[model samples]
Target: MSDATAPQPFNKEIPTDEEGKFRGYAKARADFLHVRLVVAACGALIIYIPHSWHFALITVIAVCLAEALDTISLNQSIKRLNSGAPLRPELRFSLYTAAFQALLFSGVVIGGAILQPRVTIDMFLICYLFAAVMNAGMLLYFNSAATYLRLLIYGITMILIISMRWMYFAGAPVLAYETAATLLLAYIAFRVIDFVENNFREQEQDKVNALSRQKSMKTQLEVYANKERHLLQLAAVAKHANDSVIVFDKTGRITWVNDAFTEITEYPRDEAIGRRAGTILNGPMTSPETVAKIEHAAATHSPLRIEIQYYTKSGDPIWVETNLVPLPSSPEMDGGMIAIERNITNSKLRQSELANAMRNAERSERAKSEFLATTSHEIRTPMNSIVGLTDLLSEHDLDPAAREYVVALQDSAQSLVRIVNDILDLSKLEAGKLKITPSVFEPGHFFNKLDNLMRPRAEAKGLSLSIDLPDDLPLLYADEGRIRQILVNLIDNAIKFTRSGGVTVAVQGARIANTCRFSVDVTDSGIGISESGMRRLFGYYAQAEDTTSQKYGGTGLGLAISRHLAREMGGDLTAVSHEGQGSCFSLFLPIACTDQSLEGIEEVTQIPEAPTANLAERTILVAEDNATNRMLMSKFLEKCGAEIVFAEDGQQAVDLFCAKQPDLILMDMQMPIFDGVEATSRIRALDAPQPYIVALTANAQKDDRDRCLKSGMDDFLTKPVRKVELLDTIYKVLADRPMMEKPLS
Candidate 1:
């Protein structure tokens, strides 16, 4: 292996044992001093030995040599440790000291045995054991080898003392026995000393740990004190803040108010205290709901923010956005509420201005709709008269040129009506008032109707029309009229644009979740659209080109209207085209399939038209405010075999209806005094039998129709109604319901 890849040496190990006890230079030096101290103290006991002076001098010399040797060894080890060098001290120093000390202890006992044997042996045992217990265990207990060697030397010296007393010194057997018993006592004392040293070490560790915990607790207390001081500072800031701050007591009574409160409310803090917040601040502009919300938030221990109106001491109203903060109950402080209120009078004024502007915009929109409806009515009323008169003139014999002129007039009038209808329809769509009413119908019949309607136009343009429907297609659930209208617009556009070739409409279906998605692709071989022309093709009032618009003479709204209608039915309309190949438009609709067994699908059965009733027997009331409209209606009904009675206003209509008691009443809305709704309501509330009431109004909005129906009118019809529709509604209402089971609507 290369040197770069070789393993590195580890860092030096700590000078500590498994019990985490430190045996470094400082501890070793302390041990050295302690050993010397024990030696000097033992020398003082030499007076008790036989030949006290000699024994004392010899013990001092031995102690001095032992202390010098221990000091030299400890100093050498400390130098090695300080210089960061590995220590290799000789163990002979410890071995020699233990042996020399043991021998000195033996000599003292032996000298006593050789002279006054009984007394000195016992005194010597007492002094030696005491010195061993105090210093021997502590000095070298961490060094196992030295500790064991010292213990061995003590045991051997005890055996030697026994021999010297009894076997060799002509001493009593009791002295030998006393020496042996003293050895046993010394062993037991060492055992006790060992236990005491361990206890001391444990006490030292516990003291360190206790000091660490105390320091940590002191730091935490200091941090808590700092935080408490910060809170006091914050309270001082709040007391002098510029925003009004009111403190409510447990009973919802104001207990305190900041300087800002006095400045804003024009009331001194002392006077504001002890008063209810609502009683002090609430005025004509204050809302009960906002007050209730504050009380509710306090009771529930939640916070509430509201824009509140308050009157000052000068009785001038001001708006404020107030936050009610609920305080939690605790032993140190009673529970209450703190309301921090910021003035928002200018903001409230700006909001009022915005609200007024929105109201004006709404009024403008309503006025626009009214104007459109009224204008449409005025135009259509005369247009209806012209169309009806033209129809009557067509039946008379005339020259070919005059008849052609009349036909042209009829077509032009019809075109104008269609334009008006489109404008109204677009308006309704933009206003989101056009609602889709869904019903179940057979797909085969639905497509068949479109096929029949487009076939003649397609053939007239020298193009073939064909439809391809899947055999397994089920009955569909959607707005039948809307789907039919969208398809008609698509198919008519296809026929109108294509002059040659053919148009093919293919119906394909696939199951999409619970519903089936049907795509009707209408491909036409016509003048294909360019890329730029296709970009805005489906936009409102957009056509393929200026030339196309000039030549075709159309509103260019068909595709745009068709696409929106398709989306409102939960689908979309898409188109794909090539420059020369032709254009294909696809209408996709996702409609649910109906269960055939349930027979819930509505059948397209035609209602038979009711026959005109006898005019001699029937009496009708025509309540129209417009003179021309009233005259036009009277003539139309007079021809339909009914006696017509006219009312100029709603009040007049009500009076005529009650006086004549007509079989039916045709009422117009937006009249003087009472409107159609009030008139109808009054007629229905009469004690007599209620006659059939039908609304004939220039107000063409759905809201108008809904109001008419809600006011007890049986039927509603927009103004400028066709002669056939008017006659039909009249015949149907007057016809006997019991004879027909249900009158045709």
Candidate 2:
């Protein structure tokens, strides 16, 4: 009944309307089979029909034609519906009236066959029984007018036939009962078909739903494939990036890497993947601490941007700035970091070079300072004797010619001492160990003292000396002693370089916020500097000209030392000069000022007399390693009326002091056998009066003086000792000690 477009295998998941149409199609099929069954029974029953053969044949032909028409109508409707063509509801099945009329005619025809005369009891039962059996299929195949209605028509017709043959069937009631039993069997079959048909419909629906889901899944797979293609494009970009990129899994294994990673690390992608990132790159140069740090970051899920050492596959060391970023979501890797590295080996090399240069420069500077200090100390020891002997010779009753030679010799020794002192000062500045102490001083009185010192030298040179002190000048808080040194150097240079013109000492002042600017200008009207000469004027060992140091008699360090000292005191020293004209060297000091007067300040005015150790009363130990210095001190002390005892080293000094119990000990700090400090401690430990022990060494620092005092010394003095200054210190020490009462008076 299905057309060409119909499902060859019946579509199981039919809609409610489609199921009705399908069942109607089945009914049309059953109607055709049922009509054939009835027609065959009609022929078979002809023997019982006797004279109604012609009537029976005509009745069967009429029933076949009617059923054929109704089947044709149902089949055409099903064909249109299955083909997805328009199917009118009116045309889908035969009019219900036509269907019922066909059934009525079939029933009439069946009744005629059963009721005809000459039908025996056996004949009636077989025809009726065959009709009921054939209709059984109709009950299962169609929902309407098949099993019960057909059986009722047959049963009622037989009962009427049985009444007509009452005389034949009256005694044989078994035939009637058999007929009733056949109708009952047909009703049972109807219920069975109806029950089974519901289960069949549900199974058919499940199959259709499964096919629909399969079609949808196929579409989804296509979309996923397109997304996979896009990801491949992103991978191409990563493959050629300059920086090395690698991804790690949560367990620290490499899951993916770009082509640049392989290029920089000298390992291929296949070899790198599945390997621990740290283990693969961690060679001898790579620190274990770095690996542990990376592992810790992974464990804690942290990000890192730092530099670390890495090695190539061939074991060449290099530096890298590694950047680790956490991969919160990635299909290939679990939660982990992606490390990007850039090479920085060149930068590391440059930094290493700079550090080496700095260390070398420091070492060279230290060596220079040490050499200068040693040379100064060695020269001072001998220089002390020459100056002292010359002074002694000058004081004696000598001839005029001998006295004149002694005075010239004294000048030479003093000049040598100044040069050595300048070298030591320069070294101290370079070593960053020079100490400056600021104090308040009366500018007018300080200038008066400087004037008196320089006036005689200027007068001898036939040059005028002038001092200009400003009345409004405030008391200056500065290193007064260093200031005096600078002023003296400038004034002395002015006097030494000038042949005819005068030297002027000018002091000027100005008020700055919370401070005063004091400019002391030593302007000399002689031998001026040229433009090129001023450029290197304040540099180490620099002079106005090459011949300036030789001709003017200087070590060429005074100006350099002066400049550094001025800056150290929060000021500067600068020069302004013109060729053949006078040079003005300005000493600028930013003073922490005060308005205090100098009324109460007392000056030491008493003439200083050298200490006298009465020969019969006092014994003094002189611990000096140098023979010249020892002889010089002995002659000076002998002149002072003191008996002299000599020791070559600290150990001998201790022995001599213990045995002789000297009234005083003059200790030299640096000696071979035992240093002065140890010898002084041993001498002070004796059960006797701690005689005044004076430290005389070449170390001219305040810290050195403190060290001597802490070691039980009574007084401290520097080497290249001036005759007057040395005598002054000894007299002061002896006068203060109770152990030397007679010597003090």
Models 1 onward score TM values of: 0.60, 0.60
> Which sections of candidate 2 miss by over 4 Å?
1-245, 258-260, 284-286, 302-309, 319-333, 340-359, 398-404, 470-474, 510-516, 595-600, 603-619, 639-643, 660-664, 677-692, 701-715, 740-745
* TM-score, cand. 1: 0.60
What is the number of residue pairs that collide in model 2? Answer: 0
Worst 10 residues of 2 by lDDT: 1-10
Clashing pairs in 1: 615-641
Q: Write the per-residue lDDT of candidate 1 for residues 476-553, one digit (tens) a residue.
A: 778988888777777777777777899999999887666988889999988778898899888888887778889866
lDDT of each: 0.71, 0.70
**How far in Å is the alpha carbon of 416 misplaced in model 2?**
2.4
Give the top-scoring candidate (lDDT). Answer: 1
Q: TM-score of model 2 relative to the true fold? A: 0.60
lDDT of 2 by residue, 1-745 (tens): 1010111122344434545645554554544455454554454344335546666565556555655554565666667767775644633244452445335454543455456544544444444444443443333323334334444554565455545555555666765675565446445544544554554456445656666677777777777777777777667766777788898877878888998888888999999999987778877767788777877877888998878898899988888888888888677645867888877878889889988988888888767755675676678778777887887787789998887688668667867877887877876786687889987787877888888878867886799999988888777778888999899889988988899979988899887766998899899998899898999888887898888978877877999999889999988999999978989999988888876656533242233565454445666788999888887887776766556789999889988876777778889988988889889988888776667789888765555678789999988877877667776776676655555433232
